[model samples]
Target: MYIDLHNHYLPAVDDGVLKIEETLLGLKLAIKEKVSTICFTPHIWSGRYNNSPEKLKEVFEKVKEEAKDIKIKLFLGSEVYYSSTIAEDFSKGLYLPLGEKKKFLLVEFASAVMPQGVSDGLYKLMLEGCEPIIAHPERYSYVQKDYECLFDFAKAQIPMQVTTQAIMGMLGRRAHRTAVKLLDEGLVSFIASDAHSPEERPLLFREAVRFLNRRYGYQTAKRLAIDNPKRILEGKSLLPVAGRKGKYSPFQ
Candidate 1:
């Protein structure tokens, strides 16, 4: 079963689904893509979205109840926007983990600039026994300016996720090129459908998986689409890719 670690299908939470019908449509598309488990990751940006964990849980329960007959398991998480006080917020339970294991937290960086003290915050989270999964590193402007920053992140043992749409080149040429580079460099830990709605950013897991399998190989595709994500959910160490040591592997 494929596990989607980053998605926004919950109704009226953030910039994801605005209504119950849209949420159900997104779920149907995910099901068609052979997704068995999905994590509904709403944006948790302070001073903007401000999605509290308690409120997220309440919305998740409602979505779960509505999606009861879909045969897909739903999990609650947050695509936490990175801030200077992230480590403190995480300790205060301001963000949700990837799954019930509570080992990995899905995080996003600012689009305009890399936030101050992000590296230190990530290191602190690691020291506190929490793995930080950087969501869609390919979309960030600084990393686009310097791809070597991704290597630095890898050296710091920070794992990354690339959106399926980015890989498929739907977002734009630059994002597509960056995603390909990250995958080729063995820096990406997961490939997820950051699906927000059916009309705009729908789930493209099946196409993305096929592309990975054809371009890279079956094992590489499986590692990003399945194995690594499962490991994250199970709170186990991810397998090494491209012969890298300790850190999660990408394509070999």
Candidate 2:
């Protein structure tokens, strides 16, 4: 069993699943991959998604009610797009933390650029008692060009989640390369599905774990996919990963 801390399975709220049926199908599919727990993190972007915590909660409750018999645990949260006012917004209940613990916030940045003062903003969020989990840093253009930016995040003690698709080379080559590099450097704290639809971004949790086990060893794979994510839900500190040495080969 593993925990998927980021996903867009919540229906009709964002660019994810559009219907309750899709949500159910996604959950069923996730279960098939041995995903025992999931956090329904819908997008909470500023202009694009603009989903409110209350609205998301309402939708999540309905989804929980519908999927109660699916033999999987479900929780509610949001993939908050970065903003300068994140701390203030979180205080006003404008954002939802992962698992509602009010401790960890799953955050994403622009795909093309790393915003100015984002590190400062994330630091301020940490000061306000929310540890930011940088979601899919491998997919960022800036990081793809120079993954060393993630060193700053690691130095700040910020955790990161690399999506299963990126590791599987389904997103793109740069993403796959960066994701593997992050893992090699022991910078990634979690591995999540980030699944959007049952067909498009289906949950590949088991496959990712299998791949990681074969490539990086089983303990490392389990740490990212299971142990660390469980720590987030429990409001505990994440374990530090011991990075593997040597350059990464795609087919290795």
Candidate 3:
């Protein structure tokens, strides 16, 4: 079963789907794609949109109840903005937890700039026992400029998720190329729709999986689509080292 650990599925939550109808429509597409499990990651940060834990749980419960007969397992999480207070706030002794009991935090970076002190802050979060999963590295301009920065993140043992839309060239050429490059080099740890809504952004896991299978074979697709995603959902520690230059032996 494929698990999408990063997504903006909650309605009127952040930049995702606006209404309940659109949210359900997006989910229906996900079901058709055969994506067995999906983590509903609404934005939870201090800035503009701050969805509290209670609110998040309530919304997820509502959505899950609505999608009960769809054969897709729904889970709740937050696309957390990795802030300075993340470590303190994420821990059991402190603030609210998001995403798999807060073991995994969907961290998003500034769009244009790949801020300084991120790696150090990541190390601190790790020390606090929180797994930092960077969302959509392929869409980052800095990543487009220098792939090695991503390589550095990968080497730091941070699992990076690739948005399905990026692979589909929905984000544009640079993002598409970066997405492909990451896939070829085994830098991508998971593939998610990042679907805001059915109208705005749609689910294309099946087509993306087909393309990936066609290019890299079935097992490779399974690694990115299934195994690695499972590992992330389970909060498994990432492997040391980085994406290979040649080929990755599937799910080793």
TM-score per candidate, in order?
0.94, 0.95, 0.89
| Model 2 misplaced stretches (Cα beyond 4 Å) | 245-252
| Candidate 3 structure quality by residue, lDDT tens digits, 149-244 | 876676666778888888888899999999888877777767887877776787788888887888777767787788877766666654321243
**lDDT of candidate model 2 versus the reference:** 0.88
Candidate 1 weakest ten by summed lDDT: 243-252
By TM-score: ranked, best first:
2, 1, 3
Off by over 4 Å in 1: 243-252
Model 3, CA-based lDDT: 0.75
RMSD for each of the candidates:
2.7, 3.4, 3.0
2 or 3: which has the higher TM-score? 2
Best by lDDT: 2
RMSD of 2: 3.4
lDDT, candidate 2, 59-149, per-residue tens: 8889889998999999898999998888788778798998746589999998998888998898888888888999999999999999887
Q: What is the lDDT of residue 199 in candidate 3?
A: 67
Worst 10 residues of 3 by lDDT: 237-246
Error of 3 at 50 (Å): 1.4
